[model samples]
Target chain A: MSLAVQPIDDSETINPEAVRRDFPIFSGSTQPRRFHYLDHAATTPKPSAVINSISDCYAQCYAPIHRGLYPMAEQATSNYEHARRTLQHFIGAASPDELVFTRSATEAINMVASGWLKPRLERGDVVWVSRMEHHSNYLPWQLVCQEQQAQLRFIELTEDGQLDLDGTPELFAERTKFIAITHVSNVLGTENPVATLCTTAREYGIPVLVDAAQSVSHIELDVAEMCCDFLAFSAHKMFGPTGIGLLYGRQERLAEMAPLQVGGGMVDSVGDGMEESRWAAIPARFEAGSPDMPGAVGFAAAADYLSSLGHERVHRHIVSLTRLAAQRLMRIDGIRLLPHAGLPASGIVSFTHHNMHPHDMAQIAGEAGVAIRAGHHCAQPLLRRLGLTATARASFSVYNDESDIDALIDAIISAQRVFCE
Target chain B: MIAQDLYKETLLEHYRHPKNRCDGPIQDADAVERGANPRCGDEIEIGIFLQDENIRHVQFRGRGCAICIASASMLTEAVAGLSVAGTRILCEQMHDWFGDIEPAAGALLPNGLQALAAVRQHPARQKCVLLSWEALADAIDKAGRE
Candidate 1:
């Protein structure tokens, strides 16, 4: 297998055989030693290409972006800006200026919560959010509302793990400032109609923020198409560095919001005296002090890697694996399948055995060298509605194949034997 | 009392064939306590019959990894006739006997119960290994109060 190097969505696309070649660890597995990685929703294993890119950024052209005038600094600055541009195009933004770098999507949402929305959200304002968002997306809004005396309303999720679109229209009102939602559920593998939802929110003149952490890696995303006010996602899910993530807000929205972290680099001028600290431009204004340089560089390489491999293919691969995983998991006793819709699921299949705890199941699976995830998966409110405290989740990715799903299926049966009948 | 080796085999046998995995409807029971391993979401409902602070009978009705249920099985055999104080001491001995924690430790598998010794190496499975016994101890401690 060779590495892919094509652009996004050409009919004569790059084959995954070429892409899978780059992930060396996916091959050569023994019985219990098999690295059955079905936990991509938590974090993806890095590709050698992205790992080398990080090494190169650190070893060769390590310098502060937007700080030094030296050649290495210039290279670092260019690499960092290239990553921003890659994200700009990847998410279908109008300009690179619309993309701002943050440590992770958590920080990005916190930036909006603390810096941008905090000062502006008025008391008694209604902020709507779905019950299905990760804690990172849900908690920040609650904190902001608590601080501002604004009310946080939860838009009900249907039994199928989707917001009731029928009920959703009732949720939007003149007072509904914004609706925060996850583009795809990390736990349920349910893909929300984000673009349509955002479009509907537009009619009511409500700003919508989307948490795309789970969707970005395995989906074809376009911020422009999605019509969101703000889109946030982590880079690590896409085979990039951990601490790097993207926050894509419309240019006008970015201008209206204040920066979260205020420090040296973000200021245009510190004032001659000690009186005032004027802020820099829109993107720079939001980015305070030094940023993760190598992270950004590796993120660019990752963006390049995903684009070259084609996200559409990746999405297809994962969706097919999800179907296979569900079919196999359903065969085992004590597992029930959620009614996932016709659209492509991100990469998660959450099921519980009748007499098995997810963690114990996951641990037994772990002993078999299968890495699956267990818990509320940061969707406790939804889990509570499902009458569950947690679930064992098998998430698929570009690296996963039928064999991996088979491994999981086998591990699950073994767990049943080990724990139950 | 049965040989220690007999108890070990009993533990392994019950581990392979867990007893009373489900408990429902009207039933006579001694003590019942909910055991949850928060780490892995493994929950066990331990039901025991006690007479004179000794385990008169024991049964489990819950979900978890093998070790938890197996340990529950081992627990039933290990402390069936022991007094309350003796039961606690045995639990401590088992915990201590896991490794150098029990210095000058000799041959293991005190029979079917021997598989439990491997459990110490896998920390994640520790909670499963101790779930029933811990719940049993707590249940016995609260049996009179409740």
Candidate 2:
């Protein structure tokens, strides 16, 4: 397939042309338009720096960390820990120990469910989760609630797609034990008022866990400023390699939670005189297996890449592009943008066509070399609440510019002609 | 404008005006089966009526994409009036077609059903085409057991 390399608009704070050069997928294309990747919410394409970091780790410094005494092992171990420190500073964590690496954001939330919430939750307690949570954030709590015989309730969304924060204060009853919510809605791209929700939860003496999977790539995150007890995000969403997720727990909270998995690297000592083995330190204890060494190296590079780009610039690009896309989509006949009540700055726009199915819309877009996600997007509850079975979703990232949205609009119009004409 | 081969005019016509689509569950059906693609949340409830060891009638009800709905519409028309065993064979042949396994030299898919085969290149959409057929297959099995 030939690529259509359109001229980039340099008016934006983050220049898509310069950023696209960093991402190898858009590097060699001279054609006007070949591939318009608008599925950034699903996962971002890795930059050269992140890709090279993973390659360098394996080709030059590959080793099983913490087990080897040799220099290579030490180097791998140092790099892994160095990545942790880099991430700690990236998210504005008070200490590196607050960060625990898991396989995915789903795993991080599961660890919290099984290790932290399970023990403290009583049968009569209630866990309040927002309706906008992706299954990764919702299902874990549902399973834990079912297991513990605890009551699970939802923090409903307003028609405009914002979290119904107005009703939150009264919902935090005495029996409310915890609140888990997302920083942004994966489907609507609505950046929920998490800081306000976190503050409200604190007043009720209930700790909150913020699902930062969508927000981490688009916004600047400071765990201290956010005032959440725990935060979860995935590296893949931020142009890093997959199979690595970060869970940041406040020191006191991490101390109270037991290790989700106990084995090799996470044990302080075992098989001594005592029957019970002492677990390792906070972050180490949570991470039981040999770590994803290359993943950590790549993740650090991704954090550094985003750092260099600056969140302000990234957020501005996303907001401006998303607003533009939404406006253009709205202008098209028979197209209904989800949560038309308000626009989001989070760089995602979901919509449904009156005549065409989302799957068909997405497929037609794909044929035009525009990559947009379709269907429930793993937030079925939110979609159901919006009276939709599925919708076409176009998400933006730092590398995206006006041309991508133009391609998406052309695809949508083409789909309308195909289905409605 | 480039033609969307996947959403051919024929398929879109079938989607716009689905045949044998019931507003609600089919009553007096010999057997019924529900098929769902949880990945995309496409669901189809298909029912079959058997008379003299043949599928006398078939009907489906569901909500899904154009491909899924159109495929279901075409499925009901394709399998109607075929013997129970004949319908099962057709379903198997259709699955093979989608899987890119060429049918036996003499075997060819029915003319209308062949239109849905455009989804073969789009693996994700193949499930949409097959959702109703799988349900029809299970519905037949359910009838046989009874």
Candidate 3:
């Protein structure tokens, strides 16, 4: 199940300016600020095509799917299911039936924790999660572990914030039944060695879940290649609409799992007796209500947009920008990039100012129309480990340019003048 | 321009040299309350020493943004001689002051709380300005119970 890597013509180059033009938010009457959107890790703005697709679904092909018999209904159903197939190919899943539509990456994790892990776990079982996981990935497992009286263990991070893979042998002792880790640290931007981790977990017969919310857009993901049993991500993070997320599980694993929700579209039949209800097959069983058809259409459009750009091009562009940004930002007085010695981090550059609070820095930057995120970034534990209360993060996407980084640096300098000088 | 207005010279002065920022909890404090802005990890622990319903001494201990720390410092100085009821009124007044300021108009707030007026422009940061006041309110409630 290899991912379709579009051949990159050496003659061609990615024009971020051209990419930026595709997004209406960058050049519209209703545009917010100078729109140096450095907070791509938070949510990327929708491109015109994705936005148009969503509007087209609602306007031309609007109807309740999976139940209605009208032409509009059939069109809606086809469009919605077509998005599933697009996503299935996007992540290199074995089949569309293995994909479940969730509200967000947070809900996708909750679905796996509650539906799959809870029923099989015993009191003394252990679930190993990495310290760098976002709260979305951490809290669900914590809740499930607490409910099932299972121990939740954290794989310690190295001094540079990368996962300590060397320490894996001791951590994967017999009781470790499950492993949940992030493909990339949202705070540090360190891409974990997930393939190796998956391979290790497989040897121990431990099921692994990859939280790819941060990596789906930035990295070319192939769930089959990673060999992880489950993966979760959101569309909004990748320039699609909100309220649509993907939960990819291996077919065998999904078949063994019970549904997180049981209602309308998810039930094959509700028996006269309360205990005799039969669940629908794989993906449908997990998606209980009327799906976000328009959102699905938008998500597919986003996938198509990315595919057209080619992940190789996106990766190269971001990596180059990240390295340049990191080098430039590090030169500024009082700026400290989170230490990393392994493979260079992704497009995210999280740092703190010595003389100012991150919120203050962000506020100053915001006034200058440079949008960067400040705070723990829903990864409080990681910040605590880094000896920081909060940090201002400037994350990049395909749309971001070198000028955005310059604006961020200029904003930081200006903030220092106001706060420190 | 807006950023400078938010972190005024006076506010930074207070933040750098906070008034009544104690090393430990106030000795034999009547009330102690800890307030945190969970989103940004800003924390403030306030201690109040009350004598006959009057705030005899108020001290804050913790770290946060300039707005939060400055607000706490200014709040302690403002309410040092006020009764618990007076402090409550001041809290309400502060809330109204921020609430009343127009987003576009950079109006002057009352003397002690003028630094926080800029928070009204940045709605997301309003919590940083109010963290100390919330802790003070909690301290007052705990003091009243005692």
Candidate 4:
């Protein structure tokens, strides 16, 4: 029951037992069985603080924000604005004008693709993306590039799963208009050097978009430091409620992009003719329909939760667990893991069994109460580049410790027995 | 454990040594069809050689879970030397069985496929069990059209 993580170096490690207390799913009656969740890359379990914030908002002062003039509506509107500020502060954005609330990170990426890149992209221009992107980041650029008669280029990866950024300056030609890359790969857990990439792209007058959906939970993000023109992440991936995602754009860049949607709170004035309508300022122009008010509150609480548990400790905890898993898994007879052997990676460790299929392995693990992800992980192109159809991935969070890794190894052994023996 | 119940020894035997499984391209097949489960990345290709309006031979090639391979093996065994109509009827029976719908009385699954009834409990893996059957049906249709 003592889920104490071992320290990687002299730095203190996270006490998973204490962390689990904040998440209701792991506490006493909620999970009666010996369940070990290793699917943090999919979505993290919500903490009680986030759950309570959402419920309290609806129970106490639920109202449609930015529309009503009543006291309750004003209070709710104030709370909604406060949530925006919390997220703005969380990512160290220079101003609240930079953030827009959207449906999910996928939608945020689409917004950038359709609104910003589609108009600016000229024929024969190029957009660069790494091979390791989740479909959310890759598909948007593909569609926009196809629409504009522009070319989409892929940044190759080294054999060890790191982005091949060698000769970075040489990679971008005059035709290179933009680059969008992930802060961390959801499958390989490789922490890409987005800051370095952004700095290099800046010299070429190429803007960068960092898909932070996988990194926001495990890594500290500062858009100012990253120098990315745009950033996107989902709150649900970081112990927050679903249906709310944050899109952080530079003030100057956002002013240049057209709004993806129109109507309601996003408009300042309307006329009989279509071109006569005037749009609201910056972030509001991008946010059209009624927002998820309670979701914003819960998102802020989740942001606060991550801030409370400093990113340094969280990063160390996950890296240690993932490294331990990768080492242990490679010791198994037929298991082959992705390289740099997941060391110094964020939190996920994916592998393939020479003799067993990923689905069979995942099913055995699930039956043994060890939850892992097994599939292409929505990164088929990356999987294809790796010459893999699927992989069994065990991802870690603050609430997981070495016992979860043990459970995973045991599940792999069970699968080998069922299929190989 | 659900693992033991679902991956029984007979199913494991079929998975370990699947019948009529070929590698590379089948140059002599009369018809071929491939089925893929996009969610799980399981893929199966069913190839059939027909003679006198009957399936004289059947083979499958692909990578998938134990359930999928075993089901494909059982299907090949059950459809050997059967007419196209018989194979079509067997595919219908399998669809009903995998759907958890009770079949008509005395219309039972043949070739020890009844042992795989445990797969019906898992909705996700049911696709794995049915992938080959669906591909086989398509292959038969392709052969008919030709």
Task: Give the better candidate number (1 or 3) by TM-score.
Answer: 3
Residue lDDT tens for model 2, A65-180: 98899999999999999999889888889999999999999999998888999999999899989888999999999999999999889888877887786776656789998889
| Model number with the top DockQ | 4
Candidate 2, what DockQ? 0.56
Q: Give stretches of model 1 more than 4 Å off.
A: A1-14, A27-34, A271-274, A332-334, A341-344, A360-364, A367-369, A416-421, B1-35, B45-62, B80-114, B130-146
Sorting all predicted structures by TM-score, with the top scorer first, yields 4, 3, 2, 1
lDDT of each: 0.76, 0.87, 0.85, 0.88
Better of 1 and 3 by DockQ: 3
- Which RMSD values do the candidates have, in order? 5.1, 4.5, 3.0, 3.6
Estimate the overall C-alpha local distance difference test score of candidate 1. Answer: 0.76
TM-score of 4: 0.95
Q: Rank the candidates by lDDT, best first.
A: 4, 2, 3, 1
Best by TM-score: 4
TM-score of chain A of each: 0.93, 0.95, 0.96, 0.96
- Compute DockQ for each candidate against the true complex: 0.23, 0.56, 0.64, 0.69
Ten-residue region with minimum lDDT total, candidate 2 chain A: A1-10
Model 1 chain B lowest lDDT segment of ten: B1-10
lDDT of 3 by residue, A1-105 (tens): 113535334435688887889988888887655678889889999999899999998788899989999888998898889899988999888899989888999
Model 4, A216-247: lDDT tens digits are 99898899999899999999999999889999
